[model samples]
Target: MSQEGWEASSMVSLAAWLEKHKEQLIATAVQQLSDREPLRQHAAGPVRWFFDSLITAIKDNQQERLETILRHWVSMCRIPIDGEPVGLLPVLGVFKRALWARLQANPPDENPLEFAVQLDTVIGQAAEFLSKVEAAALLDEMSHRLTAQAQTSAALANSTKDHFVSVAAHELKTPLTVIEGYSNMLKMELPEATNPRAALMVQGIESGISRLRGLIEDLIDVSLIEMSLLNLELQPVWLRRLLDIAAFEAGDTVKQRKLILDVKRDTFPAQPIIGDPERLLQAIQKILANAIKYTPDGGRIAVAAREINKFIDITITDSGIGIAPENLDRIFEKFSVVGDLGLHSSGKTKFKGGGAGLGLVIAKGIVEAHGGTIWAASPGYDEEQCPGSAFHMMLPLRDVKSGEGMAPAVATAIGSLANAVLERDSVEKSPQKATSEAPAESEQKETPLPVPVVPSKNDHNKDQTKKGGTEGGEKS
Candidate 1:
């Protein structure tokens, strides 16, 4: 239909009628709305605006203006009246009924039926707009609620898993300790000189007990890492010393496997860094152990260090089995296994040996806690070809007196809070005790602990030679 024809006759007449009976129209709507609790509770301002805008749109013959008015009405309906929607159907009913009653009571001068049809058309358009908007708003609210619930559930699950691991580790420690003590006593009483076979059996039992102890410690460390309670004692430490200790611990394994462990000491700088010696040593040991496990017998494993600006990059490379491209990052995750689980054997240095897969995770945590980063690189996975893998760990070089050094809280133990509070109270109660406990003025200056001497490659042979010389003297 032409805009002028539709507006000039039907719209103009409707506009004039609404202006003439505006008060009566509103009173009828209010009366009908009062029957419904939700619609009745809403403010009358939006309702008044709806009618006013409608009358203006009709008079101006602007369909766009009318659409804008209906949209504004829909927006008002979006708000909750009493934590519930002010039912659009009820409000639509009230307006339709009021308009229908007035039209029936006083029919228009020209084509009353036509005017009734046009009014129904406008109300139907309003109903369509309201329904579409309500549907979208409901979907948005449901989406938000579902996302929040999923996040909450994930957090709870993680917390429960960490708690269970912590409790289980602690419970297992007491019995493991008792077993280790008894095994040590058995080893001492049954000397290898007399009961050689029995001694070998006890030694096997001791070896199993040691492996169990290591696994239990790994579990405890995993729990601490999950809870973000992995504490470090930051101090001035020589990087070489830490590497030496890790290599020394693995010396027997290297010999047993007939592997070459070449640690390049000349490349290391004389400078020291601010870090936890024990924890750093543990991280290096784990990486070294991982390299040894994947390498074949008589394979070459090299450890090298170099300075990079304010950091030191320690690289340990193994020439055994390489890692696949896809599994490099996944290897650092908890309980992650790179190779086939079915072929998994239980041994630290055994080829393709399987572990709880927590060593790398603990190492990563310790390195990150010290403001460092670690990663691995490999050409590709090949058992027969022996394509190797290299792990690079970068640690920041920080002096003990530097302002950018780690805070003392990094070393604070979580379980010492109660003891600290009690000590403070005791110090307050007895000032003399506090004074006695305090260091003397001459001893105020702290001294760094002495770094132990690293074992030379031929030290093992030198020890054997010294034992032989002593036996020769005894026989003479």
Candidate 2:
């Protein structure tokens, strides 16, 4: 099998033979695999390249050019290798079969035996290259499967944890309800001033129960959110009304800390937006509660709402210890907490109050579900005497339906149409009384109501409409 014995002329004939039957070779090769999809479609590109490369390699045996060709073929085919055949030996056998049959039917002008030997050597080399690629593919596939399995296991573990939390929280809720009822009964049975010690004990009990109830509610919310079962009772909720509820929830705390509430609401009265009132109020309460908890005594917390185009920014700013720089990014993560960095920082005072750290997480989830965003900004953790935090909940003033955000011309057209409807209604509502009802014949001849028209479309831009109704032809 010396290179010299394999004549260049014979090699050229073999290469020519392969090129001529390249298609048949690919079909026959794909069919040879016992465990593979019908890869006739995928096999064509690799098969064509293989033959072309083989011919080049045979023509230039002075250097090992076949290795470069084989490397390229492997790279192209590996991405789609899942459906490709693994038993490349059987495929290469198709080439051997073709070679032997061709020689038997029409003997070569050069020595048949020598020509066949050189062709067999190249074919064997191709099979070797394919085997190496197949092995690499197997290893790569195994790695991907292992990674997928790991991810699935982690997800299952988290699902189990959420389930346990949900069940435990639900069970404890009944007992908590009973305990709350007993505390209320005791308060009613004993007068506030009659037994000072008893009154104080009852108040302490109520506070502890309230704190526990908040934690349990957070657990329930997190579990529901994780399970995709957190549904909203959507309605037109006044933003100020919700803020007022939140302020009331923190009223006692505000008074205790002497917090100066800077409440600036929208100038427009009854500024209503569609949302789940209870859940939205809860989100606001949680963020405000966080400000009340972490902020120092007598710290001024300013809660403001202003219309900003399509969105309303309900922001809570507090002159308190701000969040740690590192923890700011992951503040919304469930059960996320930061160490008391002020305790370690010599110049800063220790921040007050600790929480279960699920409030902001639940708030974020609620805001996002409303097609909005919640974000926190701060100067730095314990950087100044009172490094403040500003929590902004940006809510869309109206529902963000698809295609609602149109160009200025389109929005103006919509507004004009709305005004036309209002104008029609106003005309109908005016106390214009007729002495007698219209006769049947005259009523039948009455004109149809007018509808705003959209303009005809242009070739360059379809969105540009002619003056015509949205439904076309005056809603006919």
Candidate 3:
């Protein structure tokens, strides 16, 4: 048929055709909704309503209402299909073409169904395409949200673990320290003849207690570091004196390992500086202890401090197993042991230690807390040459202001604080006398209270030797 003839004929049949098609469309939509898919059921009511609205608009010849209803119907039809519809594609295509032909007929201006069918055909395809794009975007958004939630959950778990370790360490440290302190007192108060085995047994007990105490302290420090709560109590502390105290405390360990302890007094200033003495000493002790532990017997370990402009540079260099270049940067990380150092078992480098691998981590944390910097340097591992490791700590020196005194909350114990002050004085007078032997037994007897013989390096080694020094160091 000719285009003009078809247009005129379609116009005459349009009203009747749309009336029949509307019924068919309603029937098909109802049938589709009867399927198991919930989306189809949801779309069915709206689809039937649109068809009814279109039919009413066409009957009344309301052009605007017909256009609006057709547009809405096409938009509704765009809903994505989850499963196959009851009717086949060919049947659906024929109905769609018929609907389009009625719209293309361009009925009289008064005809309300004028552009409805054409609008539905074009709008339906566009809406369907847009719906697919929106669905894809929503899926991507959901996926990203899930990934972020998982990462947040993992981080929270790690934080909880760290908190648990910290709390456990703090709870365990106080009793262990008290046990060790009392054991030391017992050994000193009792005479060898009173119970020869008494002194030996107390020494053994003291050694174990000390090691456990050290491990607990390390864990607490690491926990504080992780939480960013490590703060320093700065006061007037004699830098040289603190070094001597650290050296004294570490003397037994050094001697046990047979490492040469070369402490150069000239390198540090004699004047008192502003800092946290106990925390500083602890930091120094941890570094020295690690050096002593790793270095072979007869190795050379030097503790030297030199003054630079406004800072005191304390360096501990040891002839021990040096760290690899790649692992140096990560050494200060929490529970991070240097890989390729062969320090851990299984020939793999890991932070697998007795007390949670917290020594180095705590030392670094304390140093940083004090506004100081601590770092390790090594020449790498060389079995033939006996590679060396060096730890350097730098602290700024500020003049002590008048009226500044130690805070009441800063001291760990009254007796220890007093002892620390006296020990500092002893070191200042003469460095050699500081490391000298204890008074003779006759002199100790002069005092009614028996003076204790503090355990020496030999005493500590006696236990290690019995256990076989080759055994890996025990953590808490």
Candidate 4:
């Protein structure tokens, strides 16, 4: 067959297929319209209405009505077919011209039925292409919107965190200064008080002040960490001595809580290690304090240190409130505390007493700043077995001999400053007896006398007139 004859036959076959499936196509349109899901249902109403009108036009053999209905359908469906609607009139004209040419070459007159069938086939293909384009464009728009929303949300979260840090810093500074001042005053003034009540009151005041100071310091550390301004004062220092001091200072609280604190010193080095002593002590204190705070009154907290090859490993293990498996990774995050894991380890909430949830955050920061690593481990939560949490801190070690040159100076400076502050406070509070060689306290209190002045003639006359008038009856 000739190429033109083959093309004509293919168009006739497509037109016949459309005619046979027209009812099925209309049902699909109705299904799409009545469906509840938005994407699927978007095409349903316009498709059904267009098909109903097309069926009416076909029955009436109204070509203009069929063209108008197809155009209205494309516009109402909002389907994109090659950037614009494939207007039914242009497509129908093409089919009409092709059919007329075919008829002229073959039979005496054109077949109108065959021409209508070809036009329907062309319109169907155009509608399918438009639907697919519309779906793709909708999906692309949704993806862009979702990505923009996620970025906006993340930006808002970071901004809120920054604002909180700024406000918390200013709020904490004033209270911290007042607490430190009163603690200094009490330490100086009540060193030798004999009364038990006075001693107890002083101890309570000091303890309260210390707790307040710790809270403020934690806030400051958090703010510093958030701002990325945490600076470490690195130097060589004896791990054993540092641990001993921390243990001693923390002992008071442990004893008051009636909790057992076992410090295992076998693993520590006899000589100093090179690192920031103050930050190391703060990190250790944070861990120990957490253990003491969360553990029950009778629970035990063990602090063990070991020197392993090139690192010093310190572990604080407590049979306190253990973490859930899901929460383990989040425990070290800022403002994160151990949530209830169904097992009442201490019979109290982990951070309800006196925690802003910044201890672990600061602890982790200090350990990392010192070129060390820290992690928390728990054996899950089980009520039958005592659930516990363990915090491990590992610091890289330096040769004791190499670090010896700088250790003494750092230790001396730290000790001397501590002693000087103590001594100055003592001198200010101690009462001194008055001595003859010393200036009299009364002389210090004396007020300067007013200078005498000669009275003017008018003032003297006024003073004499009052005296003379009273004395007139007696002196006359």
Candidate 5:
């Protein structure tokens, strides 16, 4: 027989085989689709349609039927499978594999290679035609459609954030005000000398209120940070004094834990820098508080500072349960508390305790607002071994061009809120007494030890190289 005759015979046999086992081929495709977890939900209808259309196209020797089904599949790809996108090629590839398996099991004729060639040609042609017809349209639609959808989503999210912040603030303030008023009246009625236990109960209530207020402030700060509305009053400020205040603020916790808080004052620059005094103090205090929270009892925490280039780098090293390698940067993200939420204790200063996880996030915001950067480093997380972690905060000595400051109204609102907290706190412990007592308490717990300064970039790289080149932090 001539080569042309053989080809014709092969094509005729292929069509007969396909028609004879039409239901089987469709069933095979359906089975394959059903095996995939994402496809299992709506597998039967689409798989049947695809295989039926494909077999019809093959028998008729026309592209129209196959093209329609392929187009349907392409459109279906836009709909996600279990929140993840489904791709047309992958779905089509599944049918191709199933068809190949069927052909292998029962070859149409003696020349199986020819039948295989024909099958390839059919699938290849379908793909090529799809490229020609759908590629440009898909790109055009995706460019316009996806862009518009993303913009709408982002606008909605921003509006929701603002609405949530306003609603949360208003809702929280009402209950907190009522609780505070009632607690104050109760405290006045129960004098310490007459009822010591009642006085302690009032103190506990006040402490809880303070913590709740702190949480509210943190949430407000985060919202402001996200919206680029953090208020700042930049001025020449001594960073040494700020560090001293932070260390002093942490003195009570240090004494309670019998932990050594070594504030390396000698390395700290005597010169002043441009920043918001209250805000910067808050940032430093948050970082110190975080260190205290994670560090175990009797562990050492060292605070050191040095001028590097035009920036002042403040380094805080803690002998604590170190952060995991992956969580070093993630720790600064909002509500990014590490450790098992269920296992973590409720006390804020307790080892491996639970928190709202906004301290580092707020600290990062305040530091960045002053045109600075912050990051952390650790060997890795190990509760038993206690490898430890270090945080570095680099602040510029001169004012750098940070983005817009908060609106006057927003600033005023935040100021009033903070003032309310301070005024209430003063009713318990006067500012003068707190300041006077801090230094004395710190002097008792402050350990006189050689503080290890943070390494420079070059030195850090060299150390990393020596230790098999593991990256310890994100680039500033």
Candidate 6:
């Protein structure tokens, strides 16, 4: 077949694959780029549109159109304020890569390499040609990228960071335990100490400990999420109970805002969803935390969870600085910061809220791990013109069916755990639901860890005396 003819057929194949599985393609590409840098806070719609245009350019067999599309894409690519250049080449290459991958999956009648070669030539030309045009915008980005490449180390070195953090956090546990024990001892020993400063100082230390503990937990959770070590103890849970817990947690955040629960208690259904309630609660709290950070003081935050069809729809709408439409999709990606300056991971800057940028990412990971889905929406970026933002998390109310909810492996992992819980419930007839209170102190164990006995001075003395007596008896 002629080169032109091959390109035409290849375009058709690519379009078919995209139509059937664009999300999968995008997901594959995103996962490849995720660890390297933050994702652009744009929805997948723009991404799909670009892929469609590339397909059209190929079908038309027009060099001018292809260059035009490629140039526009370079211009639209948002650079980080720090000018850390994103791998522009790798991102642009995703177009060709997706086509090549799909072709290999089905082995087109025409040799797939022919299409791949043609794509490679154009993508290469676009990268070299457009780099000059966009270099000014990418100067800082490219410089930083070069520095990173130069300093790149082994894979183990990359993971050493999380491991070190985990170790440091563990080390803190011993000291924290001691502090709690000593502080309690002081409080009990001096119920009315004359020096009031002693009490105030202890109060301050306790407060700092609480904050440090929270930070440590967040760091540990991040490592767990990254390693896929965060296990879900799955059970049948009521969706409302999880949402309520999330709302209550949000109320504790340092925000002067009103939380509105939109669901009518009388009409709300017991959304009997199979999930790890603790993981689900954490995910919901992360989403609400984002809302708190983005919304300004005196903002109105509305939260609701209702049963829709077979899924529980939990919606959080905030009357604060609305997200830019392009940024709505990016918020869930790890290490990404777009839209209003005050994102969940924004640092201690006065204007933007402080964060580690892991909240939504962890939330996404947790929700997906639980066989649920999460997404965001906004009118625009302008607070006055934009009517604020809303985040929706959809969780199944029944046992997730095959071919519909989660990918088979994720569903299987979580579903198997849920099944175990259900089976245990059937056998034991347990009464623990989402809202059940903890068992009484009499019913619960006092400690989870085994206490080690230390030998006292008196015990050592007794042993020595017994040894001496035995020696005397032997001599006699």
lDDT values of the candidates? 0.74, 0.67, 0.61, 0.60, 0.72, 0.60
Task: Give one digit per residue, the lDDT tens place, for model 6 in 54-91.
Answer: 66765566657766776677777543323354645656
Write model 1 residue lDDT over 180-207, tens digit each, in one string: 8998898899899998998999989988
- Cα miss at 115, model 5 (Å)? 16
Q: Which scores better on TM-score, 3 or 5?
A: 5
Per-residue CA lDDT of candidate 2, range 287-394, in tens? 887787678878889988767888878889999889877777788888776765444322111236666668898998888877789999987888358888999998
The TM-score values for the models, in the order shown, are 0.66, 0.58, 0.50, 0.53, 0.56, 0.48
User: What does the lDDT come to for candidate 4?
Assistant: 0.60
RMSD of each: 12.5, 14.6, 15.1, 23.5, 18.2, 22.8
Give candidate 5 misplaced runs (Cα > 4 Å): 1-162, 399-476
For candidate 4, write residues 1-476 as lDDT tens digits: 01121234545444454455555665444342334445334444555565556555544545556555644554453532233544333433433354344434433235656655455454554455545544565577689999899899988997797678768877877876787688678767766455567667778777776666666667777777777788754444556666666787777777777778888766676655666556677788888877877676678899887778788889999987666788777878887756544433432223224566788899888888777899988888653465988999998886533432334554455455446556766855666523334566885573422211122223323343223211111110
Model 1: number of backbone collisions: 0
Task: Tell how far residue 383 is off in model 6, in angstroms.
Answer: 5.7
Off by over 4 Å in 3: 1-150, 173-203, 228-231, 307-309, 339-355, 402-476
- lDDT for 94 in candidate 3 is 39
Which digits, one per residue and each the tens of the lDDT, describe model 5 over residues 238-300?
A: 566666567766788799988999988778766445566667777888888888888999999
TM-score of 4: 0.53
Off by over 4 Å in 2: 1-52, 58-139, 181-203, 223-236, 248-261, 266-270, 294-300, 319-329, 338-352, 368-371, 377-389, 398-476
Q: For candidate 4, what is the total of clashing residue pairs?
A: 2
Largest lDDT belongs to which candidate?
1
| Candidate 6 Cα deviation (angstroms), residue 240 | 2.0
Q: Rank the candidates by lDDT, best first.
A: 1, 5, 2, 3, 4, 6
TM-score, model 1 to reference: 0.66
